[model samples]
Target chain A: MNIYQYDKSKEWFQRAVKVIPCGVYGHFSPAPYAPVEAYPFFSDKAEGARFWDVDGNEFIDYMCAYGPMVLGYHHPEVEAAFQKQISISDANTVASPRMVELAEFLCEMIPVADWAFFARNGADVTNMAVMVARAATGRDKIIAIKGGYHGTSPWMQAPGHHGTIADDHDHLFRIPWNDLEALDRILAEHGSQIAAFMASPFHHPIFEDNALPADGYWQQVVDKMHENGSVVIVDDVRAGFRLHMGGSNEHYGFKPDMIAFSKAIANGHALSALVGTDDLKVDAAKVFHTGSFWYCAGSFAAALACLNILKAEDGPARMRMLGEKLTGGLRDLASSHGYTMIVSGEPALPYLRLADDETLMLQQAWCGECTRRGAFFTSHHNWFLSTAHTEDDIEKTLQIADEAFKAVKKQFGS
Target chain B: MIDQLKSRLNLKAVLRNLEVLPALDPVSAELISDWNISLRFSVWRDTQVVLDFHDGRCVFHSDSKESTSVNLFFSSPAHLNNMFENQASPLPLKGFTKLGFLKKEFSQLIGRLEYFLKPAAETVQDEAFKKVNLALSLNTAVFAIPELMKLDPVSRRIAPQFSAGSLQFSVDPDGPHAHIIFDGQSRAVAFPGPAVNPTAMTVFKNSEVAQALVAGTLDSFAAVATADIQLRGMIPLIDHSNVILDRLPLYLQ
Candidate 1:
């Protein structure tokens, strides 16, 4: 096996830092990449389930652009729909019919959606969801899971994060994930002041094992929120289409009053949505939320085509099958190398770590080696599987992972 | 909140660095070599830190003892802070015999420290001077986090969020390193050198990167993106620590 070098990637990054803040800010920043030398800093191009770094190293990408490239990079049906819509009309003075069509499709597809609202990113819709919840209940407080990430809004960011003040979290209360007793306690004290309880369908916090909701956790949470006259919001932005066609809530056998969807929604297009029950439709509209480019039609067409293809091809099941095979193979490979790989969360979106090292240094080194060997794996974040990943890709990834495990063993010990 | 944190930082983090001045600088070592005395700085009803000089070295302690040495008292945190800022003077309550030593050798030692901490443009061009400055700066930055976490409103709120573990910050290849250990109960203890089995780590690629980051001449986020700095392990701990680090310049400057 040949090792990869990133001279060109490094050069581009050197240039980028002069012009761009953090070179590639947000989730794409290389700050979290352990042994940063082993990872490429820039990409040249991407296709189905693979991308070529600026250094010309090809990788079997498992991150899927951190959950945006769902069906795959440059998915044929989605691109064609976007192109057709743009060639006729996209951003126009009068909104295109595609907007209505996409909303209708979403309302029909999602179990809880009676109406759909559009936005440009997950944060836009999530911020709107909070406003709508407060408007409906006339309350000032919200309860959320401790580590649940909604978006980068100041209110959503943890207290003491850069540019955030202590009062930013004044009305927000956090409870541990799946702790029903904590919920009961909070409701007992601040029930009337609580407007919403928002969280992801499953816990996928970084640098820790992902957790699924307890057997009756969501159902009980929903019932309790209703009794308190507050609404339930499922921030399904990251795990939306990958879990279930309707919503991740549907997969968990519970429903939320609103489901915020993004990431895989338009198969990499810049679009997000907040769909809510009819009871909150008036409140949602009255919140007075709008973005300049929210009426763009090309992404709506792309989303309609993408969702239709996902429904036809059973994209979630396909991703789950692929994820299972990949994780199982990786686990066996770890065992063979005298290591224990703890895999958690749903099969479709798996977070892997090495049980051999609690500090995660070993896992980080393994991930770095795998990334350098052409399987783009991040140690801390959950890996996303897409319908474009075939069995061959999985096999190749396992081979790379095997080599990575060997490299880690050679560096550390058995 | 700012004044209280600044005062604690002045005593615990800033003044505490005096313990290392002898090892890092020959002048300071010589000045303190013949001295056998403990100097205590007390803010009324608040905090007291003692610096003991003996055997060509200095050591810091949080607890006070009934030793025959020197004691400087301040009426409040603001009074202590004003002394650090050179706007006021401490009222010596004991050891009138050592006042000459304090005025001459001790004052010169403090001058040397101030020279390193607030270096002139030409002095910083010297490689050796730059190295000592970077080390002291790193020490001050790491030591101040615990004080801020205990005193600053925003940092106090963030302290409990840290998982109980040690976070190591290091400059690569034989440069300085420091550790901050969180007990998961809003208390943190900071010390010099690498931590064993740290829960998280932030490493600068070399002395150049470390100096740039510590001096605030380089953007940290840009450095991370360019791999001049690397972060690993439990990232939330590192992230929360960085947030506290962000406020360091406000007090340090």
Candidate 2:
């Protein structure tokens, strides 16, 4: 067995703790990721579907840098376009033509989107979307799913966190997922006060397995939002480009008034897009949203290139096909080991958990073993399949998973 | 209004709610462990009570006159109402209330208590934060400060050096009232034991600034440089306490 050493990573985490506060912050922090003892606290470098930790160990990455590298990191076309844009200029005093070009491409790609806005991250776009909703509707209340994650702004950080002030989330409503009755109950009371009902394109929680919209659930919510005069904001930052070129809205059979996208937008570039219809165009323009890095034209060029290549190659379909094969292979292997692996969400965005392991210890043990054996997978967070992942890669991953399951069974007595 | 006030001001329940911060918010708890106090809060003819801090837990009393550590005098319903609502902020406490005095004793309670504030659609925005506070007890610091501190990130770092340190505070309007004991064994903060000999002690101009300092919402370093808090011992400890006691707001997913 080739076990990756964490001497360097351990040393780095200790150093990081001294200055970085909890060693590191946010989702990327190693503490929140399970099997923490085995996970690397820092990444040295990454290119195309794989990343090397600070310790120099390599693995076939399925985390995809936590839902960013869609076109298989550092794709030549994307990189070439970005390089060309950078050679001319990135951020300038005046608005770059690339911004308009990217916006035009987005409005064209996403059928329902008539206008687009640029931001540096998903949180910025979502926050801006809320501001735009409030500005447009003249309402203060916004509703989101109970456990689904939006980003970490003051309003969206979970309720009981020590530092959250009373006013921070006073107007935000968290309702149960897939429950129409609960949705109706909240809307009945605060319907007129609500500016928007925001949620992910799908139900993907961090600890729990992902779930698709119950049949008619999405349509009903859309109808209700329309009936109540509340805007629907599909947070497609994670499920965007992966589902369809137009985003999850295209596949889900409904369109949202506002869609915020980032994560995989530019094939791992730090760029986010807020696309909406003409109705919200004036309000979107009225909202104050700007980022120093958001104006960097290089990211815009990369985004355009990534979009072109993905559409031409039909990247979503290929990713789905590869992901489906990987899911079936992993399930068979797990079943062979007398463990049932439940891969939730679509194949492109699979969330793995055990059918029988309620506490997730067994799942953690399996993922720990898999990563140790050279498959960079997350136990709790969802996994992303990309075009960079090949059929051979899937085969190799299945082999590694089989061995990992064996280790899991031996350790956990399953 | 008095009968209505009794139902709205539940100070005892508020203190009990905050007793859990040491286990949950490690940084705020550790900073709190350095102090011990038995301050008395009196609301005219209504309720007079004593609160004892023991091992990260608060012992609440109702209408018992057992020689409290300090005495808070509320002249009228309006005074108690004002104190209960605004909390730590300067109120019209007669002429020259010297709030910096009360703040020095019970300041940390503000920030540490916020970690326990649950989600609600309409939280007490202008004060009476612990909605329960609007119902029963007259003791105000426990509920009011936590509500105010929610805007700032509570400290997440746990410091071991505060374990042996102790600070006693005496605010005017209440004399020799509260004490802070940080005699824990490890980085985890606990209530200080009796017979604590302290390294440093301090008084504030009023409770307004003192609560802010202990909460780590207001920088203790900058507070000292500005002489916002009067000190009695180990200038360096008071100067550098917040370094080990604070972080940006945490939203762990």
Candidate 3:
């Protein structure tokens, strides 16, 4: 399964050093304890089941751009749609045929999305959700969970985190996530003062894969926030499109006041949507919600294609099955090697842990072992399985995992 | 007489002239009641000055500005002098006698003065911030004096344009308060928490002055000043360094 040699990657890395800082934009994704140099080989191109770097090295991609390429990289249909859009007009100026088609598709697909506002990135829609929540309730403070990645915006981080905001703009009020009792205490204490409770249904950096909320966690948060005169904002940016076409929220049988989504909607194209209830969507209109680059047509066409493919005979179901098989194989391999590994979250997105000390060192060791064999990147945070990945890819991954598991057992033997 | 007071001694104009308050040029006399305590000597700014019967109790019912000032009287002129000197303490205006026609008027001024004397803390800290304070109760780790402003050579190299500032910090079990006196100046900016957000942003931004400030490692105001910490804000006021340091620590939390 392995394609390229190690020495070639070193040369490419040397070339990268002359140009970029850290040699990447968002690739410092090693477990905190992992050695800096042993992260993973950089990517150049990817095809069905596998990808390569500038060094011409190949490895099975489980990082999956942290879940955006759910159909895997360069799916033929998705790419074809993008090529058509590019040939037509690049979809920037005149309203592209795909935008209206995509919007109508979303309204028909998701039960809650009556009106849709499109953007280029997850941060854009997430910010719009917060702004609309505030205008609907006419309150300034937002309540969000700890260790959630809503975005890097100052206002969004303000309410959930204290030190995350600037001193000049001190309106943020942070609250702990998941614990209903703590949320109730906060709601009772500051009922009239709060604007909304914005939360990601799944935990990100803390737990691997998907950390499903406790029983009735969503309902309780919504009920309590509403009682306190605050709206609810659901951050489905990563969790959306992975579990279902309507997103994972429908699985829980609860509807949020607003939902923000992006990754995986367009294979690799950049497009995001902020869909909410009728009342909240009205307020979204008043908020200044315009971004120039969001009008890119290539992304919209790709998204429409992705959504159409997602509902086909066996799309999300296939991806989910692949994810389960990969994680299940790793667990079996680890157990066979007498290693007690902790792999949390939904089988749809799995991350591994050798011990309680989930720091950088262990992450580095695990990732280095995988890279040596040919599993490209290890996010310790979340794992993504694309439709492009097949059963043969999973079998090869397990074989690599068996070798890595033995090495880990020997290295960290009790 | 009313025209003379409006032209010569309009309270709002007088406060603006002194620059003791921010400009209220667009606001009208009717809106003075909503002005924050920071705006001093403005028209109808305070309901009326109060004249206490015991030590702190007071009554002034007149709505007219004419009768408000006359009815109020201070316990002693010396007490009034002392009130201005110590800005931290409440002003004293205790004694009052029914001075003929003035009795009804001074009562109104007493009510307005009470409203004017509300603390600045009430205005700057909003309701949301109050909830945060309640949610987080801290037990701080204070740094020792020698560790307060220990400079690092690497920080200086990274921030070559660094200027040394004399920094002081105080550590309580709850949190650290830092004050930096740039170049031996007494005006220090006080930062309330561990140097976190501002320090991290500054380090990321490649500012040597911020690097020096981090190297100073200030925790609170009690620690001694040293030539380790550096500042790069609106400077030249060394004694007011506390204001700068005070705001820096909040970002860390």
For all predicted structures, in order, the TM-scores are 0.96, 0.65, 0.61
Q: In terms of DockQ, which candidate is strongest? A: 1
Tens-digit lDDT string for candidate 2 (A275-380):
9989999999998878788898999999999989989999999989989999999998888888888989989989988775664667776787788777888776
Q: Over the stretch A21-45, how does candidate 1's per-residue lDDT look in tens digits?
A: 8887888888788877888978869
Model 3 chain B: weakest 10-residue lDDT segment is: B138-147
List DockQ for all candidates.
0.64, 0.03, 0.01
The best candidate in terms of TM-score = 1
- B174-245 in candidate 2: lDDT tens per residue? 321333344433222212122154444445555556545444476443333233554534322332233322
Off by over 4 Å in 3: A1-22, A27-33, A156-165, A206-210, A356-360, B1-253
Model 2 CAPRI rating: incorrect
**Which residue runs does candidate 2 get wrong by more than 4 Å?**
B1-253
Of 1 and 2, the candidate ranking higher by lDDT: 1
Report candidate 3's interface RMSD in Å.
18.7
Write one digit per residue (lDDT tens) for candidate 3, span A137-226.
Answer: 888777776557777675543221223424422555555557888787777777787888877756664323345788888888878777
